[model samples]
Target chain A: MRGDTPFIAGDWGTSNLRLWLCGADGTVLDRADGPGVAAVPGRAEAAFLDATAAWRAADGPLPALFCGMVGSTIGWVEAAYHPCPANVGSLASGLTRFTALGATMAIIPGLSTRNPQGAPDVMRGEETQILGALASHPDLGIGRRLLCLPGTHAKWVLLRDGTVVMFQTGFSGELFALLRGHSVLGRGTDGLLPQIGPAFIQGVQRSLTSAPLPHLLFEARSRQLLEGMSAQDALSFLSGLVIGADVVGGIAMAADGLDGPVTLVASPILTDAYAAALAATGRDTVALDGGELALAGLLSVRAAILS
Target chain B: MRGDTPFIAGDWGTSNLRLWLCGADGTVLDRADGPGVAAVPGRAEAAFLDATAAWRAADGPLPALFCGMVGSTIGWVEAAYHPCPANVGSLASGLTRFTALGATMAIIPGLSTRNPQGAPDVMRGEETQILGALASHPDLGIGRRLLCLPGTHAKWVLLRDGTVVMFQTGFSGELFALLRGHSVLGRGTDGLLPQIGPAFIQGVQRSLTSAPLPHLLFEARSRQLLEGMSAQDALSFLSGLVIGADVVGGIAMAADGLDGPVTLVASPILTDAYAAALAATGRDTVALDGGELALAGLLSVRAAILS
Candidate 1:
């Protein structure tokens, strides 16, 4: 665990696994990907070993750190959730450690909290990204802020003084995919990406109203039938509707209202969509790369364990 | 057409076709079913002929009247939609008449209206039911009543003096199916009907809040993961969530608040679910049999055309 000892870090989720080989100085030397925890089932150890064979060969017996669903019950080994209000130190101490394939490995525990509605909510990979963002930008750890991690299951997180408080999960991404792929609303928009234009903005605006989502969603189909909206625009409109609803719900879930710029930790595509939707609601946002934050979060955990 | 001449009346929709063999006095002698518009693309005429061959052989060539999607562009013939402020008279006048297999046929046009959101909404089979309900219970036509026809695409119709003024279509039923069959919320519930008990009532209460649906939906999963909610309860909760949202939206979409008993036209199962959800909202509902109403509606259309 010395400062100059090279190691491997990973963010393994339900769909995919990403691994980064870091030098002793915490610089990323190389990166690789393998089947996610879900893909390997009982063979997660084999998949992990094969994905890092080259790295282990070059840097013998390097310790490894992992985050996300790779620590869930279905993962290599269960890393029981770290209850909120959690931070880097708590997560580092709670890591599920074990030896497999002649290498020491630690999987970061996910975070669990009760949302404002008094329902349980959980996040695995996003906690690392949030911690990484805070560590990389120390100023963000000083005051209350809202951070949104948009993905298959978007997270709306509240941060105070570098510690994670409560957050809500929105199924907008998954719902959108299901509707677009399996519902009648997606009749003609096959293999087409959502276009963020007037239709999308209109959908966002519509979502802000008092109309229930199930009612508003019908407009995606009705508009095409009556208004002659193109298939691409209908898809875009559908996208806006779901994302807009998520953003609206997220803002309401935030405590004391969002008085500051919300930090968005996501890939560029999601970032753009979220930023646009947030802007439509008269809110400001600061964007950060999710991968970079995950790496930084891992490094912070490494530093914590070492200290 | 004479008053004592036997005729065939049908409610042909997207999924299935139900036909009633009516005596000259409008009494139903027998009933048969056939494939819907979606099932027999270009072979609608052939399917219709095959389904009614036995009846035709016994009664000779009888005139037929049909309603619902049988009039859509995809049906046997495009019975163009009758615009808003439609009544029995309007629907009868708008019927698309034709001759098929040496028998005269007339298809009742669907109703089209722009919702309060200024978006076009259309209904095919429900319009017939609404008109039939009004014809059957004349008292319901005297005032401003909200009639909810719950089905695959639930419709909330605003009736004024027996005329269909404006209505909104809620995709709740379709959405519920999609989520239950394909989404993560439906994960472990295989072929189980939603039990409308505490979980469903709780979901309905939850939907009445300001929270966005995509966020509230995740509770179905989180509760199972953390609170030990059974798969059946999760499915029931999901159903309540969608249906409750639809009711809330329908109330909002109503030109005036629901001040009277909302008339529910649906099958027994849907009636029980909708009635329970509506009751939870402090709204009184009067349930009617959908089949009886559809038949009554078709008979009313015949009377309108004859007059």
Candidate 2:
């Protein structure tokens, strides 16, 4: 495969899908989105074809590379998880290859590792993001680095010389969603948006204490009843508490004595929250766009496969 | 107000209402139930009147005493929170009295106190349960005691000479329910009942570490995916993690340096789970029936009012 040959790349997850049509030099010529693996279930191939129908008709038989839950049991094809201490080359080699719609398609294997607690931890899409981060920043490939990818199931990865040594998964994002959408504390917060204001800072600082999360979370409601904290502030405060707990836990599990600015691979919104949280704990952070990193990661794997 | 004077007592919470028709001596004459305060909203008085219609017809103008969310803002009347360091006498004096359907009615004011973290904590029905526990066991009233009332918002209460001096609330039960009912970890667990088996013990033990909660919780999903853990065990494990975190946090907040077995004021199922979690940490537990305690507490309040 030539570097200039057009290709298709995607980062398909549980809830959404993003696909890019790239030129030989990895410039995104076009992009499309379709149902996530969860939505398509047994029909991932059909969904993928539908999402890229225009691109396929225009370009004719462009190879496709995918990462994330699209490789899981529920995905188009079950790609076996590449055991950690994995880098771009390992992931590329472990990719699950198949022929779909008369074109070569491969799903990048997710990474699996044992967390600090010796419990099994796994990452699907975030593995590609971390790899992309490493590819974009050569400096990050040196020595040791800690990367925090905030999402529905946030991943805290410890990288040694650009290889993912270990990682831990935090249920913060999903927990926050469930709480805000369903819990009692979220009762009157239907139209409210969480702000990075005093309430959030207070929640972050409160989460830093020895008080357990369950106890602290109730403050979202108690404060409203007792101190006149508005429902909007309450939502932000709840967000802070959840994210702060994740940061605290992630640092404990992955950072430890390792010294460096925690690399945050996420969108602007998540970066703002995570950066603020890390800053509160007196840790520095360097931000990277997760979307771009996913593309770069796919390119790196493509380079590896071609080589 | 003699001990054998027939009266109506009820515990009305967010989801359901439980009412008892008791003899003057506090013996149960009959029992009935109705929608909780949350269901009827501004029509709590009507709901109460409807639930107790049969009891009222059988026994005319029986004085009624209620506790729990019935006193909350959403309940029948907005009973003000009685500030703690409070005992049965203080609570009796703090009762929010009213007349509904031409009968003398009272709603026990919930207790309000600042948790160790200096955050506001409040409880409605649990206060009555605590008072009932004290009345049923005089030994509990003489010393500093720690009581764990497990429910939607589990309460950890510290008692000094029968007065609720301080307390903390853990959102463990609600979190567990939310995760089981809504989160990804709960998928495929529709009909499976959580058992206190190896997975639960493992979860409890896992939560005892300093790894923080969000990280520990994800193990339920990861273990299932990678280690072949069943949905049943995963639900139990998830339950253990949430409950264990609460127990750990509760002890740190309310039971610090306090001696004697932790008194668990809850129903049998909750008792089983809480006891298992506490026992894993070498903490001794004494279980008491929550329903019985509610009745006993109501009787104590009636006695105090008469005195």
- The number of the candidate with the highest lDDT is 1
Residue B135, model 1: lDDT of 85
Clashes of 2: 7
Residues A58-118, candidate 2: write the lDDT tens digits: 8887889999899998888898888999999888888788898678889999889988879
DockQ of every candidate: 0.84, 0.85
Candidates' interface RMSDs, in order? Answer: 0.8, 0.8
Model 1 chain A: ten consecutive residues of lowest lDDT: A251-260
What TM-score does the first chain of candidate 1 have?
A: 0.96
* lDDT digits (tens) for residues A1-307 of candidate 1: 5567888989898889989999987888999999989889999989988999998888788789999999887888888878899989999999899998666899999999998667899888899998899898898887788999999999999888888888899999999999999998999888899977899999999998877889889899888877888999999999999999999988875548654698998998999899999999988898988867888999999989988
Clashing pairs in 1: none
TM-score of chain B of 2: 0.94
**Model 2: CA > 4 A from native:** A1-4, A253-259, B1-5, B23-27, B253-256
TM-score for model 2?
0.96
Docking class of 1: high
